[model samples]
Target: MEVKIMEGGPNDPACPLMVDSSQVTQISEGDERDVVQSLVEIIERIGSYGDYRRTQRKECFNLVRRMKLLAPLLEEVGEMERPLPEEAIACFCKLKKAFMSAKKLLRTCHDGSKIYLALESESVAGRFHSVNEKLNFALDDMPYELLGISDEVKEQVELMCLQLRRSKRRTDTQDIELAMDTMVVFSKKDDRNADSAILERLANKLELHTVPELRAESIVVRKLIKERSGQNSETTQQIIDLLNKFKKIAGIEENQGYGIDNVFLPKSLEKSPSLLIPNDFLCPITLEIMTDPVIIATGQTYERSSIQKWLESGHRTCPKTRLTLSHLSLAPNYALRNLISLWCEKYNVELPKKENTSLGSEGSSEHKEEISAVVRDLSSHLEAQRAAVIKIRLLSKENPDNRVLIAREGAIPHLIGLLSYPESKIQENAVTSLLNLSLDEGNKRLIAKAEAIPAIIEVLRRGSMEARENSAAALFSLSTVDENKVTIGSLNGIPPLVDLLREGTIRGKKDAATALFNLSLNQANKLRAVKTGAIPPLLQLLQDKNLGMVDEALSILSLLAMIPEGHGVIGQQSFIQTLVELIKEGTPKNKECAVALLLDLGLTNSFHILAALQFGVYEHLIELVQSGNNRAQRKASSLLQHMSKCEQVP
Candidate 1:
């Protein structure tokens, strides 16, 4: 399409230089290794621009400097031991591709018609400006958390993107003036000889006044036309027309056989060296992101169907390397599957559906018989016991009614026994099964009555991460029954759970916090929790913004603060400062909790009230009294009244 011009300049149709879609870099989709290597190659290519006959050398060097800054981040990505999650690989690919296209544009500035370049100097700036915008887009697309990028490198890249965004409005007066003068020469079409001195100056400006220089210019413009093959025809034609004018002024002739016939074959750009699957998320066989990934004996992960198909086809080998397999069994790759799930959720891509296995009601007598098998085979083959408990876990997970049936069939006691198993997976499956069974109210009582609380707490202290996390969950579920809460606390469950809350995974911490929250609801267990030193972790969780535990921490602290031990530990000036911060910056619910906690503290100690005043809490209290929620308003007004009384007394 002929772009509309702004009525000046011979960069014919110097419209905002609308980027041609064809100019967008097309990165061939590759596997994890290829993705990392592509990033390295693109960075190298971008850095390879020499100082050879380059226009806008400063801008080109600036582009190189920006790309070099990203190399440290790429090196970190390359050194990562784990495969880059599919989404992170995609981000790297996008960043690499953007730099690749920018490299090509920079190459044009290095070797294309210098007189045409000097003429369209503003357009040259626009090209540099355009690539920076592309880079900004790629950087904005990546989720930094997916990659293991260091804070320093991430900050540098972020700052680079900020500069690129701000560079859009940058201009150069010299380029603009030179561009206008060159346009005037192109405008005087018939009066070609009328500006020999102008042509001499243009030739001098571009170092193109010599015959050999004229010959080289003709050859380059011709080569560019052949390379373009007429895509950027108007720009190439302007380059041609300008080159020919210079030739006429230099008493030289255009070389028709300027080696355009050889068709300088560019190297193949397919860049195919590895797996056809696009990324780590994809199954090597199916070439799609695996919803249910499984690892085979060869230690290769593939979608469930891919593994099934491979084994079904009588191929006893890993599809990726075609290597011989030691065994045909496939294990669930829970870790990669989880990563894929997070990637899908982040990108808002829906997972493909699997057949629904969740029955609406309890399984029949046959299923009950299977539950007996778990109890019957409790001390049998380890694998069989594991398989049985996993079956029980799956059944219990299907529905609440099924859990009642599974518990009645005497699987809970055996599952709890298996929690002490030596094999980690069996222990994980067993504890998880008990956790599932404990979801039913009756099963919660039975599981607690079976002396399972100590065993579950043992697993919480030393089981596999999944097992420990599930033990905490099981504790939380069982603690839901008011009677079981006392049983759990009496079994010495509160301390290990407090430890898990202090030093566990985010899920484990959440589960431990919830169990503690429920157990603390019982007055005696509140003292038990306090004695176990739950205050420090609770305070840590309150300060953590990413864990989403602020509300729960405040609630638990508010409850514990009602007692003397809680008040002693939680009523410190630092804790009070955190509450005041919450009142100023937290959500309305958070404000209400902070206000209530502060009011409780202030009613007992004048220091907390005065500290509130000293921390500049009066205006915040005034704002809360006006616009806060009803509970917040009431709490704030009461606190204000308390502060007023404190001021009068002191």
Candidate 2:
């Protein structure tokens, strides 16, 4: 069972190292500070993994010590008031990737199978060495002088680097001995020839003495094999086979042992280990695996792009918690991200690349020039104008910078003119281009201020379905500004939007509903919408579950109920009956909306209250008051109080 101890060189955790210079992509300087801070936070969490991986304690200690030295420097740079020099930022970006790799390795040590890990000690040690070398590589190239760091801290960093350079060439001898013992125990041809004493010692060390522990570690090993993306099938199968041998040695029967510890750290991690897709891995909105999960203030994680879109659409509450977020800031969830990355690796799932959402930040000089040329073509002949607008549409949707460049290139007025073109293609591309451009927050006011609202409204009234959809979307995005809401309402925008909401395709209807919702926020526009036959279709949408818009319809009706005319229109017996039914049979949000609408209706119309009372609405109201959410309970109580005030009539 004797084996020679290996020296640390290429696989040495103590070797001085440098990351490949080419892997250092230029990160946006504006984001580098936050990224550094995030790295610091993740490293802090990684420090806690020392409690596990007793076999790899030496490697874990080395990793934690190096990170402890790196954290202060990271925080110092993150807190610098002056802009970080481009060289330092580049170095930090490279370090960001390296630090994330270190984190993944550390997480594996904590979550992976102890027996499999013990058998693969050299590989695990090599991984630790790799991360350390990357760290050394990053720090060695870092420009400490240009970083504006204090001399005392600079010397400490220099010492840390020197420590890595002088690291004694040695591997954990205990891990080496354990691996030899395991191999000798398993390599024997006969049970009598194998060393049971050595096997017993290995099992205790691997924490496989109990049936449940052996079974759990086996599950962990299988999970590791599945998640170890890009590994050859032969290698994965070998690891799985080794795991089964250990389980057989431990005398545990399949399906008889207790599985993953029921005491999971978070509710998000409590899914059965056998499930291919963990429930928490999915974005609540998209219901797909999240590529870039972020934590909202409510401590709920969601796909970053999805939640950003939700915030942009003017929703201020957490999607799952339904509580108003204290602030709009989204913190990166490094723990969840590592967990998801592991899950994706196990399944060999290729996650989508992280998109650069901060457009115009990249070195997009070529895009700027090309977009300028394209914007000029908007004034060319019909064919050229159509071609130019198509290019502009793509450019505008691609980045915020393109939208800025397009506006500056004099494409806005040209696009506004094309919005009225008799040619449906040009009109569709033009309105759609404007719709794409309006995604930029600054462009919202620019688009509305350029006298484009009137033309956009006209397109909403008569263009093709796609054009009308985009027109409605543009109006909705633009109407975020208070002045644009008035401008749109004054230009008779509400009628066309209401028309689209009633008659358009699904996307068109969604766009129209959103625009009408935004426009209806204005007191004057609410009357405009209610008077233009918007009520009938909105009410009709209540019973149509397939539209998934009962809440939207109720929201609009609630706003209109503030006015006498809209309230009278919505006070019809059928709509009140529908709201009552929803109170008894809807989702939590549906019940809340239904209660609010009924409360709104009864504030001025005693007949509506009498109608609801006739339907036995009191029982539902009492139930909601006792068990519904805060909003629903308050609204329901108010409805009951209002109903109680109404006197008997002959």
Candidate 3:
């Protein structure tokens, strides 16, 4: 089957083909005839330049250059016509691959001087310019519409065009303008007037011949002022007003004398002492004047509502001091509350009514009896047990005292028993109740003593999504006890937890990672987790966008990287690269973890030391040494010293 390239029509037999017809037919099947025919025409057009390589080498070289540019566009066209015939797709792929191979082979066949000689002979440079113009005109006329293209493919093509435009050299001012025009066009096409407006402003600013850095800063400041002006915050509005007044008083023009460094400082801009509220009168949590003030054990006072909400959410530290509270107790700071009230009165501001600071602290004995009744009903009929579990869970969430009371009623054993029940709902509520109860330090021990680790592991393995998450949370709380960590690992709990890390919901993943993190603290448990194939999922969790999970995941990996087997598993180039990236771009804690992990890996092998250097870890370490916290700075300094010694050896 000979497929000849016809100049006019398929029946025009007088036309000459560039390659042997047999070669064209061998490249494609019958279904691809039309697409193959179109491609062959393009190839023939490109091959015509070969005839002139000897007498007109420059023209031929220019033709080849034009074909090089068109090759990407041709590939893109083929991509847009998907659901395309397999033969056509195959033909395109083969053509692209073969063309690149042939070009490479041709280049390798000649020395650089000989290639230059051929290109420069026969006035080729002048002739090539003519050929280039013709090729550009032909490309301009070529029809590559978006008619049959999918939206995704269209966007991809547009992105390709955008990248090509961006990669153009900007040494020429014309190129910069063209780039700006390209951005404006793209922004308009996306129906984003804000983006287009930004581009237009940049172009107009460029015309002023301002320094790029100054112009960029000016634009940023203007945008900030505009955004702040629109916000409803009083502080933001005040800042905007102050800026405007400063500009007016200093006779500063927005376009002319605007640089962040050149701003005039006025004495009046400093906050006056009269405007300051006494620090002790402000709640540390809300940073506002205290109303219904309550004092924690750390001696820091917070608004009652704020402090209660913090404690209810399971935080156990003073917001201001970060000292662990001796208990979740809040006593009314009557003196501070009265001072705030007097201050408000003197300032002619209306003081808000005091919040109800009590959370049933003095409930009647009847209420206590009711809670005890619910705890005892756990052994009754199934419906009664369900209601009782729900009531206990509610009570436990209300106050720390309630949690202690529920724990004293011997609910831990019943909750552990209900975890293995047939109904998923019962298991979920039971696990929820246990999670709440375990928050109490005393109950954590009792739950651990009851050997509830196995039941929680069961829920983690087979419960519903919510149930699994709660079970993982319960495990996390229980593992806070050193004994439970050992027990959970010994009960084959590591593998299921690792499985949850791999397949659980976002909340479940966080809980499982945290649980594994706690368990990994035990040396034996770290080995067990790694033996259960926890490293890969842990590494995968490091890639998560959730900062909490990433932090926990990194902490676990840091611990695992200590042992010989753990070091060997984590010292892979890919893992090292991920850590390097995190060090450069992740949150502060993540940066700390990454630096620590890299330090561990570097200790295991000189190869890791070299790998870290390749990944630009030295600069990050130097930065950390200068500015990071004590732990980060210490580890980074040690690693840097070690790396420096390695560098000195040669």
Model 2, runs deviating above 4 Å = 1-363, 648-650
- The C-alpha stretches of model 3 lying farther than 4 A from their native spots are 1-362, 546-548, 619-637, 647-650
What TM-score fits each model? Answer: 0.44, 0.46, 0.46
**Candidate 3, clashing residue pairs?**
58-124
Per-residue alpha-carbon lDDT of model 1 for 1-650, expressed as tens digits?
32221323224334213323332233233355565676678778766657745457778877887878888887887787775665565455456556666777787887776866775565566567657876777688666788867899999888788777666533232432233236445644334111333454466668775545665565576566667777866766677667766654443323333322221111111132121222677555433456788788988887676466445433455655668999777788998888867865665556666524343223344555666666677657876787787777676663444666677767777887888878898888888778777755567779888889999999988888878888887887777667888888988899989988998998778677767876887888889989999999999998998887777788788778879888888988888889989999998767877888898888878888888777778899999999986557656877877777775432
Q: Write the candidate numbers in order of decreasing TM-score.
A: 3, 2, 1
Q: Report the lDDT tens digits of candidate 2 across residue range 1-650.
A: 11111223435433222222332334344565666786788887897775667788776777778778877788788778887776676576557767778888888788787865776665676577667777787787789889888887888888778877654233123443354355544443434211333454466667765544654565576566556764765555555555554444433222222222321112333344444567677665544467789898998888787777556534567766569989888888888889988976786666766656563223345556777789878888878898998998877764444676788778888999999899998899899888877755567778877889999989988899988988887887677667888999999998888888788886677677767876887889988888888999999889888877777677778778889989899988888889889999998878987997787778787899999888778899999999886557667866777777898421
How close to the true structure is residue 555 of candidate 3, measured as C-alpha lDDT?
A: 68
The weakest ten consecutive residues by lDDT in model 2 span: 1-10
Q: After superposition, how far is residue 420 of candidate 3 from its true place, in Å?
A: 1.2
Sort by lDDT, best first: what order? 2, 1, 3
Off by over 4 Å in 1: 1-363, 648-650
lDDT of 3 by residue, 12-87 (tens): 4432213333444464444344553455456555554343322233334533554554444555554544444333
Ranking 1 against 3 by lDDT, winner: 1
